[model samples]
Target: MADIFDKKPIAAFGEMAETGARPYYRTAAPDAIMAGCNDYLGLATDPRVVEAAAAALARHGTSCSGSRILNGTLPLHEELEAALADFLGCEAALVTTTGFQANLAVGALLGPGDASFSDMANHASLVDGVLLGQGSRHRYRHGDLDHLERLLAAADPDAGKLVITDGLFSMEGDLCPLPGLRELADRYGARLVVDGAHDIGLLGACGRGVAEHFGAMDAVDLFTGTFSKCFGSLGGLLAGPAGIVEYLRYTARPVLFSAAMSPASAAAALASLEIIRTEPARRERVFDHAERLHNGLRALGFSTGPSVTPVVPVHVGHAVPCLRMWQALHDAGVYTNAVVAPAVPRGRALIRVTPQATHTEEQITRILDAFAACGRRLGLVPERAEHDWTPVALARPKLTP
Candidate 1:
């Protein structure tokens, strides 16, 4: 009989040789540039955020010790929720121990006689949340509004409907077509829910996220986000109507069973939120870096598909070459993420790079130079004329929120 304790997958999963804060990592190649982090504003290591977290640690110790519904609710949690609701332009917000739980909490809203229409490329948490619910699930091709509309049109009109998508696709780095989604949701009498985990602190003029950027905040019924990204902390939040939030606060299993977010995380997120509100320049700087990096990579004959955000993916077309490219960059003092099979489609493997607002111009130039050299060495770079090198327009149009 075969052994039940098979561990091949675990063995294949390699560990990070070095880990540290954003933009740089101490490794064998010396000060390796960290291009895989999601800290868009670089506030994770900012003194103000650090100090706030430290103060909270001193005052409240560590864990909240119980679920929010039990003995764990804190004033900080309430304060954070209030601030998040106001910032995201929602009536109320509920904080969860992690972003994954926040999405799971949304599943609590689903039941029999309901349906969830999800984008195929949505984050795993969103996929899992749909699975957790009792609703019938329907998945459409990524960004395929026509397909989504077809699915919606075919569903029973009387059934409760939820249209779910990511505000910014983590791997593709493209913004969702919120305006179209809004129209579809309204036409179908469906509630629209956007998970803005990657774009909340970086996209809109007021940093509200893709919905705000596209003038569709009113179109969305609920918004979910995580502090682990631009907020420079840990925890997740779901914001929406006061009644819906209150409902999830009572019925969500993740909320009722999981421990409350630590005091330090709440304080750090609160401090980071204040910084995000006060400092618009950080948002501008990160976008500039993204454009610069995207343009530079394309100039070197590497394909960056449909990216307009900091999360740029360099398409390598296969898992083996993708891993080779990652190792080459890593050995040359540039660190990036190797996204392979299960995360993305097979033969669509790529290197994921994200730049921070705090990265210096020299650092950006160094990253470009490394890619240029590595691409040439790996024969990944073809003659400029041989490839379709048309640049993607990265400029954001001015808009008032």
Candidate 2:
């Protein structure tokens, strides 16, 4: 008999499990290592975060029991929303059950007259938001201001356009050219929305994000971020002008219908925010770990893409070879990610690596040693360094387009 599972190609991960070469989860013994999670701050294990969550769970019980639009509007939710507004310096904020929902709610609420211009590399949430908004949407090439400018020039000047982009692209770890993005939006009279899911607590003066990085905080129209990443929580938020927020609270089906995030997650996120302000070193440690890995990989003659942030991808451009390196790294107890075609173009195969603020020097060294050993084992690295080899990790920045 024909079977659905039999006809479907094996999942990339199922193939790995078949080989008995890689474990499906991060290590927990000795020193645990998680390669692909977005926990940039390492706050999931922090005592204060755990305590705050425990207190919230004790006070509020297990769940909110309803949507926030109705009976779910608990005091804890209000407190967290208020804290977020104050913390991010926005006029108002609406916390959603997940980061995906925050973007979805906002994108869905921006009525018929509005439109959105998105970056090509935007996260799935933002893309989903625009799709649900029921308005016109156009995506300019990743970070190409020229492409954005040209598109704006061609569109009606009076069109209500929202320029949306990820502050720090998740795959490349490079920041959007906010200076240029802001200028184009200004020239074309469009509002700007920055998806700072990968930016907060890792960029800018106090981690307010790209606006903080580019000194254009006041210029952005809306900012959205996730609690899952640096905050070590599971909710999402939209911080922006008061009226738009109040409008979404009443409308936006996702916000209106979705159940509230648990009190524990909300409280944990609130505590993480306090720590973000008090301990700036977490942000510094992000850079420290990034530099060590970036410098180490470059020293070994790997083709790491332009990675200004902690996320790094070394291009191998062939699927089989890329998988081989990923398998080797996983077997060596130094975990990593394998990115392939369609998610990227057909010719661009990558082994993506992320370093957290809490990663130790020993871990960093282990990671490099694994990559070096794997590269040699697979003949990806020459017997000796290429005569023309130069460290390309930070040698040049690619303009998004």
Which predicted model would earn the best lDDT?
A: 1
- Model 1: per-residue Cα lDDT over 175-275, one tens digit each: 88899999999999999999999999888878888977887678789999899999999999999999999999999998899999999999999999999
In terms of TM-score, how similar is model 1 to the real structure?
Answer: 0.93
Model 1 score (lDDT): 0.87
* lDDT string, candidate 2, 1-401, tens digits: 77766665435555455544343354533443555557888998899999999999999998998999788888888898898898788999989899999888767555677667899988888988898886667899989998988888887666688899998888777888988888888899998898899887777767777677777778778888899999998999999999988988888888889999999999999999999877877877777777777777776778667777778787788766777787788777766777765466656778888888778888888888888889988998865665454543431211121
In candidate 1, how many Å is residue 225 off? 0.6
Quote model 2's TM-score: 0.90
TM-score for each candidate, following the candidate numbering: 0.93, 0.90
* True-structure RMSD for candidate 2: 4.1
Clashing residue pairs, candidate 1? none
Please count the clashing residue pairs in each candidate, in the order shown.
0, 3
lDDT for model 2, please.
0.80
